[model samples]
Target: MTTTTIERQRLSIQTNPVDAEFQQQLDQVFTEDACALLVELTREFRPRLQQLLAERQRKQARFDAGDLPDFLSETKAIRESDWQVAAIPADLQDRRLEITGPVDRKMVINALNADVKVFMADFEDAQSPTWQGVVEGQVNLRDANLGSISYTDPNSGKAYALKENPALLIARVRGLHLWEKHLQVDGEVIPGALMDFALYFIHNLAQRQKMSTGVYFYLPKLQSHQEAKWWDDVFRYTEQKFGVPVGTIRATVLIETLPAVFEMDEILYSLRDHIVALNCGRWDYIFSYIKTLKNHPDRVLPDRQVVTMDKPFLSAYSRLLIKTCHKRGALAMGGMAALIPAKDPEQNKAILAKVTADKELEASNGHDGTWIAHPGLAATAGAVLNKHLGDKPNQLQVLREQDAPVTAADLLAPCEGERTEAGMRTNIRVALQYLAAWISGKGCVPIYGLMEDAATAEISRASIWQWIQHGKKLSNGQLVTKQLFASMLDEEAEVVKGEVGSDAWASQNFERAKSLLLDITTADELVDFLTLPAYDLLP
Candidate 1:
């Protein structure tokens, strides 16, 4: 058989080849040997993935039936036990400011070269899982770790390259539920999360070890300690298969989901040997909050704007993260300040002040570090964290035991505010704009002066569904029906078409974005995630 045909056999699926040259590169990454290993790994853990996902649905049903989440009683001893995660490595000691962005090649370079202590290269929320996008992102990260990544714009002739003293890299792989449809092993498509994590860990381990920085990760969407344990098992198996030390791979778990927030201690304990911190994945946490309690009328959230961290439930979640992490000698990392630096001086000044206050609260409350979405906000976030982190790697020393105890009521605090027509219109606009960008293979977009990702879009659509499901009405006494949302979407489409001009508006992607947004928003039943359906539209 020809070499090209033989290579296709290894992938065991009919995927359109990017080109011979690119195919060769992919062959190297997904060689028969590598595919065989991944097949084994997938088979080993696929059942657990199924169970965990099923558990998620089961838990959701209970929530829908009026049950509220609380601390896991079965894991009480694990939480009450006196134990701490493994020691933090020197390179990961001070994560004062971490910048997050997609795994796009230019973005990878910019984020690494940005002035932050750590740059989380996201393969989950900030990236569309196109075959090219998924595979090329791996190649970019591989080159970035080796200091050989660069890009030149074909038209503008502008160039990008990594600078000296680049931020340490952390990879955030996809969650358990998503899978790559392009490449299959024995007719089964590989889990996208495994593909992302395995490809990075396999390729970059040696380079990072040579640099002595280690392979760090950010774990996303974990709903239970058992899920964390599943990841822990995966880590163990990966290290054993690769001949690395057991705890060589360190990860910071994102306490984003409502169920995850309740099991913080248990989650930490489950991955104690390979964990260094627990991050407040705030954007998605808010989305998950709405998803978890959507059945309860009283739990319906107000305008997303008013659901700030100071709100009862969010405040409790934030403080509890700090107290739990500090007590266990782990870092309590804060969530993203999603504001980008605006051109208007007054607006930028106001946003900076707000970020400063947020960071100050986290620092004073014993957080070790925080996240900034844009490079410009890094310095501002750093300044606040530095005030508390001065001369010390982290505030892991500050045991927040005296902080007010966070109870189940605190975590499930009922939402309080007005639902306005302005809010509904805002959600419609942002969701459409983001969907348009995402369908165009851009997962991260700046809309209305804020950097948004899949998490933001998730919140946008999930909130709409909750509003419609619960028959929420705006201050104008209008019910949030599908027709109401579609009408606003139509108006927003015209506004966007005008903003982007006729050339963009007439494009196929723009049309698809509109159709996709309408489908998700106005569907009879809520779509679990917009990305799942959107993934089918990718090349």
Candidate 2:
């Protein structure tokens, strides 16, 4: 009987049919190199994904229960008057210190604490696109509460209490993708939460009891005049829907696109009623340059260490932007000084010195203010502002002298003839290099041996092209024939032969010649050269 008894086999059952199927799929599809990834997918990702789904469900449930404050309602409470379009005080506008807060919470608190005029809490480049993080950020900004944290100088060990300043806290929201992500749950994009948050914060702030000045937004990635128009429409719709005043939402569009460079006036006009200022986003602009010039084999982004503001194309473009903004009666704000190192004291000091010099240059060139990307950089901004504003430019001077109206015709103004053929040819060379770069999609090109890596190819090309396009029209009172222009281009191409090459000799010499041309040409000479009608054509 004992001999007849057999050991019973213990059975193991696979309870997860999905896991089995997933493993089978992996085994069939994954190669050896991918097997590790497959294992991670099943073992690590599945559980994390499940956890994320559960958390999302919880958040949705809370949202559905109306646990969150209604954004539209809050916005309605803030936007009661003509607060949106009220002219920013010359003092505030003239106050050049711009401190960029790392996070919304930090930015809001920093704005509350710092003496800088503009405090931007970034959501575009500075943020991680995590769902919980974004939601919490929105909530924190919407609530406009930064708990009782002491604002202190890390170096000096000085602390101060930060009071809330409605006007100073500029909330930079997530771009469209993150915004969409924020509203989605289980793959369904429900914009109720995001829209609610935006509407509540903007509208309510616009309509608040003290009617504290309307909160501003820093608009990023504006690609065209149409993009600016789109934001304008969104703002209008949001305000109207919430019964917020028609123009209660104000924004500063970062001109980061190649198209945006040419359409600055158009974009400004489109958002004229709603825009507070125009910011030149340098890094993004550089990135755009790289993308636009991807087809060009000769141009590569110069090493970052070599890039500097003095490069011919960069200097020219910077000047052009400043002039254009001033002509429009809008603030021409300088680009971000984000290179400041927060950890290294010496690097910080050197950056501050450069920043001070830059701000002086910008202020002299008519930029209203510049950007600072850290709390530590606030002192740099403060010093520059104090020095520049110590003897403020007479507001009457700014108000009385109307900026010369720039028309399509003005874009074609020719350089006055008071120079030698060499000088005129030099100007033409600079203009041609810019045009080639533009057509090839580089926003800025480095002049070898002169500027490290400062000039933007896009800005140079746009400025030069605008002049050429407008000049052609003005010169002949009609559009120039492309065939006729092509002939001139061919001739010039021969004269400037080997200019577009990757060889070190060709590259170095070309840049050197271009830089020399920029140096020798006078402002008037350059303008005249830009406006000069096609050589074969007569004025």
Candidate 3:
């Protein structure tokens, strides 16, 4: 067989085809010395993959059979008057500063005082699952009571409460499908009835306290566009039952699934008329990637730094998302800036600077808002956003800029040997992995012998691009050009061609890589910029 054919075989293995003919060919190609080992591994993996596919088929069948309970029906069964009510002030949407406080303490008061857009009082990921904690969190939010509530650290036993202006609040609720019993530390099951009661109680309290309008929710883990549609229907039913306006209750769905990416158009259409926006979710997305591609151990995630947006596939995906939201005339908000290092002052400053730079890029790219997990980070984000928003350009101009054409030479700019090189390499690897995985029809695949799947590709690409466009760079060195990057990709492809055959694996990987490289080539000017002579290192 020719060298290209060998490379194809390698690609086929990475892609994982179930076709008997392909298997036969692969078997024929294996050497006697390693044939048994490869066969054993294949034997072990095939059934597991089959099982996963079977499970998916079963779940889809259940859905088609209408076995999935209707959340709207459940929500509508409750009476509107049974919950409390409040009018959402018109000015709430126009507020500039937004604050999210972990505990409802003085945070709400601070937010209100600061006149922020939203005061998010998180419950799902932030607070303990105990009923007492839920009740307390509700009370603090409902009453806008930021004072006289002290929290003791479970580990350190240190106690503290807010003494200054509290942030305005929105609450994040537990997913309707997540059972408290499953999360209990004491092994005690919390009944469904209790969970429902808690939801209603909080809903009622918010209404009664006249906190209706800004009393929004952060919905978690919505798996499909259909799920968003269900939630919209539920919202409509609940509002009518409660005698509230159709759009009174607002929500942002966390887009964190592979399926969710395809369902984006549907999801937005489903909630377009309702109070809904998309929030890019990272951690859960990573978890989902792992779960979806567990059989491909070779595609396991590497270090966090390795994943970023400079890679072609991810950059395209993220841009597509932003474009989708913008097309719908809705907010295209950026994902969480969790990687902002806050422990070390210098590191925190550098990360904040990077985040600031990113926000500018996002806003420039047409995103309206972004997220920051911590109070400190929020302040930094606010500053960054405020600076960008201050100079917010006309929509027409932005669109024109977005539509402008560029060459492959522009997109492949070399990274000056500084940290940027590492960043670029990371982005390239991630992009290659994503292209390999998606084109191969496998949920995950290995690149340069490392395992990577869809989720990793998405997050890494989003992040890396954010860095490339916004991260700090040196001033003196020559930047890599798009032509150079194209050449680099060509070199990589030639290497693969020499190593693998034109079999299923090589075919899929090469096609995917070509598509991704073409995407990058068409979009931006890839050029390496000069590195600065001296730069302040992040601690």
Best by lDDT: 1
Please give, for residues 380-482, the per-residue lDDT of candidate 3 as tens digits: 6776566656654212122323553222222222222233555445555555645554443333244542334333454444333333333333233434455
lDDT of each: 0.86, 0.46, 0.45
Q: Which stretches of candidate 3 lie over 4 Å from their true place?
A: 1-116, 145-167, 182-214, 296-299, 309-314, 339-345, 391-539
| Candidates in descending lDDT order | 1, 2, 3
- Top TM-score prediction, candidate number: 1
**Candidates' TM-scores?**
0.96, 0.53, 0.51
Q: What overall lDDT, based on C-alpha atoms, would model 3 receive against the true structure?
A: 0.45
Residue 4 of candidate 2: its Cα lDDT?
A: 18
Tens digits of lDDT, candidate 1, 203-290? 8999988997678899999999999999999999999988989788999999999999999999899999899999999999999998
RMSD of each: 2.2, 19.6, 20.3
Tell me the deviation in Å of residue 345 in model 3: 4.8
lDDT of 3 at 218: 69
lDDT of 2 at 345: 74
